[model samples]
Target: MTRVIVAAGGGGDAVAAVMVGAALYGAGEPAVILTYAWDRLLVDPVPGPRGPGDFTGLRPLTPHVLAVPAAAEPVAPAGSTLPRLAAELPHTFALIDPHHGARGIARQVGELVDQLAPESVDLLDVGGDILARGDEPTLKSPLGDALTLAACCRVDAPVRLLVAGPGLDGEIPADVLRDRLGAPVATLAPEHVEALGAVLDWHPSEATAMLAATARGVRGLCEVRGAGLAVPLTDEGPTVHEAGLEEALERNELARAVLDTTGLAEAERHSREICGFSEIDGERRRAARLGARAPAGLDPDAALARLDRFQADARARGITHTTFRRIAEVLGLNGTLRLDLRDLLLARRPEQYEAPLWRVPAEV
Candidate 1:
C-alpha cells in the first residue's frame, strides 16, 4: 500500500522533506508528497483567511507536489497566507502546522483524518521554534495539545509525530509515542541537516543526490567487513597483490585472449612463454599445435555441446567455485549463490545434504 507522508514546516523543513522523499524513492517506494502549512504569512487577497489559499501562487511546483495553506487572520494574521496557499495545492499528501493551542489543532487534525480516512498519513511538525518563540499571545502554543489529539484520532494507521530541530522538546517521548500513538518517534539525524537545507532551497536534484549518498554509506557499512582487499607494488610491473580471485580470473582471461590472437611480430615467443607450450615458427604451426582443436567438420550443435561439457567439467572440478563465490560475495549475491548451491547439492543426494553455511538472518 502507498503511505502518505505529511511534512509541516517553513523553508527550513523543505530540505528534510525532499531528502526523506528521495531516500524512500531510492528504496523502491512511492514518491513522497510534501505539504507545508502557511502558519505565519499574510496573503495578497485576504487579510487572514486561514485555509489553503496562501500557497496557491506556488502552483508551478506541481512536479514536487508542494502545497501551501492560506492565512488565518486576527488570531494568526501573519499566517493567513498559509491556509490560502495550502487550499490551492491539492496534490500534497498532508497538511501540518504546530498548534498554538492543543484542542483546536487536534480537532482540526481529527477532522482532516476523517476527511482523508483509510489513506495512511504521517505528520511531521516543521518549524517548531517559530511557534514556541513567536511574539503574539494569540499565537500561543498548540503543538503539545495537537499531538495529544492527533494521537487519539481514530484511524487504521497510527499518527506519525515528527519533530524537527529544537521543536523535539515538547512532543511525546519515544516510549510514549510507541505506546500511545502506536507509532515510532524518530529524530532527524544530524547528517540529514544538509539534505533538509537543500529541499528548502528548492534544489531537488541536490537533495536526491545527498540521499543517494547516504544510502550508499549505509549499504557499505552493511556489506564490508575488516580491512578489505589490499593493493600491492612490485618491481615486475606493480602487480596487484592480495587481489580477490575475481581479479585473478579477469587477468587470466586477458592473457588467454592475447595468446590466442593470430598476427603478432613476437606472437610465437609470447605464446610459448604465456601458454607454457613448445616453440612454434608461424601462425599456422601454432594453430595446428597449441590452438584449441576444432571438432573435424562437426555440426554447430555438437560443437556447442562439447564446449558446454568442458565448461561444466571445469566447474565440477571446483576450479571456478572459489572465485565465483568470492565475486558473488563482493557483489552482494553470496546469499543467492549459497541457496542455489544448496539446492543443487541436495538434489544430487538429499540424504547427505545439510543446511547452507551462509545463512543470512531472517530480519536482514
Candidate 2:
C-alpha cells in the first residue's frame, strides 16, 4: 500500500515529507504526498501558493484534487520548484489548493484518503510550526501550517502529526517545542538522508537542509535563512515526533480561528488579526523591492570576501552553522544563484560545508 504523507507547509516540507516516508516505508514503496505548491519569495516571486491552474499536465485524482507528476510544469512568470521535485523524488506529488481555504483542503484530503487506501495518513511539518500558539514572538509563517492543521482535523482518516527538526525553521524555539513535541516516533538516520540523494544540492529550504544535516550527525547553533535567527541544534533534531492532533488544535490559536474559513483571504485575515502580519504580504514587498534578476557568475575571490565579512559578524553573534541560501542572499544572489553559490563555495572550500547546514569556514 502507498504511504500517504501530507506535507504540512510548502517549500522544504515537501522534501521532508519524502524523507519521513522513506525512513518509515523504505524508498522503494510508492507514496503519495499532498502538499501546497507554495515556495520561498525567490523561488516563486509571485507570493503565496500556486494552485492546480498554475501548472500544465496535472492529472485529476478527484474533481477537487490533482496530481503533480514529473511531466507537470508551471506556466511562465509563475515559477515553481514542485515540478522539478516531482521529477527528482520517487513518491507521487499531489497538489493542495488553498484558494478555497480549510474546507476545500479537508474535502480534497478526505477524497484522496479514500482513493489511496494507505497504511497510515501522516501530516508532516519539517519544524514544529504546526503546533504554533499563533502569538509566538518568532512566528512569521503560521497561516499555511495553521490552515493545514485545521483541515487535517476535518479529514475522515486518522491523521498523524509528524514534526521533524523541531525549531529548525526558526518559527518556534527548540526549548519551547521540547515539552510540546512529547516523545519521538522515529529518528531519521544517515540512510534516510541518503534516501534524499542529490536533492539537497539544489533545494533552498534552510530548515529541511538542517533536518538532513542533523540526521547525518551535525549539531550546534544554526543561523537560518531570513532575519538571522539562530536556532539551537540538539540530539532531537532528526527525530520525528508524533504530537497529539487535538492538543495541537488547542495550542494553535490561528488554526482554530481559521478552521471554518472558506477563502485564503479569510484565513489570512484571521492570521493578521491574531498574529499582526501576513507572510505573503512581506514576500510581495520584498519581490517588488528586489525585482531580482540573474547576476554574472560568481567571482570566487569577491564572493569569498563577502562570506568572510558576513561570517565574521555572524560568528560574533555565536552562530556557527548556516545554509547556502542564506549565504547567497548575503551576496545579493537570487533563488537561481543559491545552488551556483553552493557549488562554487563547496568546490573552493569543501571543509567548511556539510550536507545541509555548514560550519563557517576560516576566513579566506
Candidate 3:
C-alpha cells in the first residue's frame, strides 16, 4: 500500500516523520513524505515560507507538485536539511510549498494522491502542538502545523493525525495531548529512536535534544530553546498517538477555524488575530529589515569578514539573536547564502552561535 506521511510542523518534524513512517510501514517499504522547506529561523535564516523556487531538480507531477530530489540531487534550497533525508533513506521525499498556503497545498496533496494513489495518508506532527487551541501562551510556530492539518483534512483520503514526542515543541503539554487524543497507538522503539538520532547527527536540529532525551529514557521537564519553555515529556518516551482527524479538530476550536481558512494567508491572519502576534515569522521579518548586505557567493574570507562586522554591529546595538536569513538578505547573497553564512559563522566563531539558530553578540 502506498502511504504518504507529511511532516506537520516542517523542519525536524520531517526528519521525525521518516523514522515514524519507517516504523509503521516496515523498513525498506517505499513511503513518500510530504514536508515543507520552512525550518526554524535558527535552522534556516530565510524569513517566510519557502516555495518550489527555493529548490532544484524537482520532478513536477503537476503545476503544483510534490517533488523528490532527482536521485541524490539537492531538493531544498542549499541551506535546508529537510531534503537531506534523500541521502539516508530509501523513501521518496516530496516537498509541499509553504508559499501556496493551505488551499494550494491541499491542491498539491490532491494531485499527489491521484498520481501515487496512496492507500493511507498520515499527517505526522513531531510535537503535540497540532492539538493546540491557538491560545496556548507557549505556542511559537502554529501557522504551518495548522495549515498542514487543514490541508490534510481537506483531502478526500482518510488522513490519520499522528502526534509523536508530545510537548517536545513546547507548545501543548503531553498531558494535554493525551487527555485530548486518548492513549498512544504505539510508542517509538529503540530502532526508531536510533534512526531519528542518526538523522539528527547529520542535521543538528532543535528537536534533537527531545529525541535524544527520549531515546535515553530520560523523562520529566526538558528545556528546548526553540520552545523558550521547559515543557514536560512523559516518562513513556517518544510515543505516537493516533487520532481521527475529525476528533482532533473537535478538540481545538482554532483548528476548526483553520479548517475553514481559504488559504495560508487567511490561516496566518487568523492566528495573528487570535494570538495578537505572528511569533517567529514576525521576528524574522523584523530582523531581516535591519539585515546587513554583502555580496552573493562570497568566498570564505569575505563571508567571515561579513560575519565579523555583523557581530560587531549586533554587539554595539546589543542585539542578542540575528538569524542567517537576515544576514543573507543584508549581504545580498543569493542561493545558499544562509548555508554559507551559517558555515562561516560556525567555523569562525562557534561561541557566537547559540541554540535554535542565531548569531549572538558575544556580550549578550
lDDT agreement with native, every candidate = 0.30, 0.85, 0.66
Clashing pairs in 2: none
Candidate 1 differs from the real structure by a C-alpha RMSD in angstroms, to one decimal, of 28.4
lDDT of 2 by residue, 171-270 (tens): 8877888898878888998998887778888878888989988899988788866777787778888999989999999999999999998899999899
Which portions of model 1 show Cα errors greater than 4 Å? 8-15, 20-36, 42-49, 53-120, 126-140, 143-152, 164-197, 201-364
Please give, for residues 1-364, the per-residue lDDT of candidate 1 as tens digits: 3445544333224334434443333223442343334322112212211333333333322321223423322242233323332333232433333222223333444555554452445444432322221222222223222222232232234554443322122222223222222222332333433333322222212112222233223111111111222111112110111111222223332222332222322333333454343122322353344224432332334433443453344344332211212223332332234234334434543542111111122121
**Model 2 lDDT on a 0 to 1 scale:** 0.85
lDDT of 3 by residue, 1-364 (tens): 7788888877677777766775777666677788877654544566666666666666766667756663534333335665567766666777787565677778878887888898788898877788887787777777788788878888887788888877776677666777766577777666765655456533544454465456556544433343123445455547777866776666555566667656566666777777666655585774575355443566778766766676576556545544454556556554455566667767777875443245445553
Alpha-carbon TM-score of each model against the true structure: 0.30, 0.96, 0.74
The TM-score, computed over Cα atoms with residue i paired to residue i, of candidate 1 is 0.30
Candidate number of the best TM-score = 2
Predicted structure with the largest lDDT when compared to the true one: 2
